[model samples]
Target: MIKKITTDDLRKMQNKEGLILQGCGGDLQEWQDGINELLANENILLDGSKFENCLSFECNGITCLLFPFEENVKLDTGKLAIWRLRSHSTFGGTWLSDYVPNRLGGYLAEQQKPDCPLIGQDGNIFNLMGIASKTLRRNGMADQATEMCERITQTAGSYYEALNIIGEYVNITSAEDADIDEDQGMVM
Candidate 1:
């Protein structure tokens, strides 16, 4: 299916092999049809490629398309290039492999460290996630809390990985630290 994805979603993807058509403005449907027609004329459609095998997105106010190939398939870029140049906005095409997505770094830099009381709690991954989610929501970062939990559930493979994901969104305090803070509060 031609899924609509965001720039962040695109950045997170790995090993994507496709053609990216950018700078498509005005009627998106017309552009989609034109691409399908071009693919048909070039015998790409005869090779079992379909319109549903593409993805649509918007970058910098221009509509874009991603024609994903499951395996290594060479396409005649000459026709696509000419077709793009004839568009109203002068669309451009690029090999998906040319764009390198940063798997980490840029995303982690934006994370907030809300304090989460995880040390004294059950070591169950779900339990720790709950504590962290509540703490994040209390800190007015409910969206981030949800995203963090989703990442853990979707991508984390083991208990330690879940903890790592949780740590990305919150500061986990040890039981000893909590006790020390309480004791210091009483003395103060």
Candidate 2:
């Protein structure tokens, strides 16, 4: 079943998580406006301003933003048989400090990559790399954090692949033990 999230529920997730709005039933603009109104009714403002049907929100130190998404359904028939496939994909939501990377892009682009990380040949840190690096720094693993930054800046791959690799070194058992292994390095 689809679980409906309430404003109170969102408040509970403040600072701990952000919402990823998707699959609203409408055209693009209408969908965006729907989410904007839903959040506005909950007292969440777009960057603490009046509602302009924008995609990013800030309230009580919590941040929420919409990521780019695609939904595809396919049907194939061969040899008197038919096959159907349905898939949903979404990308580009990384928690960075008090906000997401590209709020403006959240309004304009199909893929919201405001400050998205560089991948493959670009060799720059973006998205999950930023999040993991931030997590490492907050945990007092400055050296490890530095190493993570360096590693991500030098690595090459898709966002999902890079996130999985970096995530290997970022296990958190508790507040006291973020469990970042120094010797393991940033690459898996």
Candidate 3:
């Protein structure tokens, strides 16, 4: 089932709407409004994050700006992204200093990453790489992520594939552009 994680209810929920994503101007609310407009019945590619974590939904069939999204945040799709978002902090809220996700999990509670990491084993990384490849390919990019993945798999092998894949992806991302396709506040 899909749960709507709002910024206000984040503390008391498991899933999140992923409203913490931000960018240069901090005026991304307009972009968010567009996404929110498509909640429930429709979905859209989340703008402003590097991972391309898009969510599809229209309104709740009710009249309200707060859209209820379900199962949208997958590993690379929309699931884990929102999971990671709960670990993030906004102007208010608490994180590592105030709380911790898992004992050994990363404590980016800082909430300042272009995108959340794909946290998992090599297999998970491979799967996530596929998702990113497909999303970017669908977006009409040059498919750089998959291209490098294939290269690494063929030459450096699978052991180094994840590292190389991540290395390649990281090399091209500038801080500002990194979060381009991520959730920069799902306002619409």
Candidate 4:
């Protein structure tokens, strides 16, 4: 079974530092419950309909997007894996441009190559992927990303240096700022 992000972890993130992550793929209801509980104690940005239906809280303080759905999740080792454990899920993305921040993906834009993984997939791939993300194999079949990453680093040059950002996450368990601005709650 996948190790769902712990409630205590969520609480620690929001109250102490206002950092939370969303990986919107699997049972949204489960994630929904987690956020609703958090919502009862904090100010969150969520799509009313989607939040009510899937219960995703695109919290204001979220700064990372976890990506374990790639061909080899283990490729996310080292610096990147840490970010995955803490980043927001691309599930909340409204458009391609907004999905992956330029830093992580800027190299793709420059290369102008379609890096998509082996397509021709069948059913319920994303669902299985979510399960995998919760507790994926430490090492999967994909080649180590180190070499590719190094190549990217060399290529990104000045742009990568400029775009990289150290993000923040919150795990609030207190109700001190538990009021979701009635206005920001609009399902955007």
| Top of the candidates by TM-score | 1
Kindly report which residue stretches of model 4 are placed more than 4 angstroms away from their true locations once superposed: 1-26, 43-50, 53-99, 102-188
Candidate 2's residue-wise lDDT over 1-188, tens digit each?
13333222333333442334333433445545654454445444333333232244433444444322212211111310211011123322233222223332222122211221223223443655666666666655555567656656676466556665565557523221222333346321
Task: Please provide TM-scores, in order, for all candidate models, with all chains considered together.
Answer: 0.46, 0.24, 0.25, 0.19
Higher-TM-score candidate of 3 and 4: 3
- How well is each residue in 81-131 modelled by candidate 1, as lDDT tens digits? 555456525456665555433212233224458667688888988888888
As for TM-score, the candidate ahead, 2 or 4, is 2
Residue lDDT tens for model 4, 109-140: 11111122112223243332322222122223
Worst 10 residues of 1 by lDDT: 100-109
**How does candidate 1 fare on TM-score?**
0.46
Candidate 3 Cα errors over 4 Å, as ranges: 1-117, 120-125, 170-188
Stretches of candidate 1 exceeding 4 Å from the true structure? 71-89, 100-188
lDDT of 1 at 11: 55
1-188 in candidate 3: lDDT tens per residue?
Answer: 22333222333234443333222122334434544443322333343222223222222231112222345432233533443355334322122222223322333332221232343323465665665565445444343545656666666656556665555543223334434444575211
lDDT on C-alpha atoms for all candidate structures: 0.68, 0.39, 0.37, 0.29
TM-score of 2: 0.24
**Global CA lDDT of candidate 3, please?**
0.37
RMSD of each: 8.5, 19.2, 20.1, 24.6
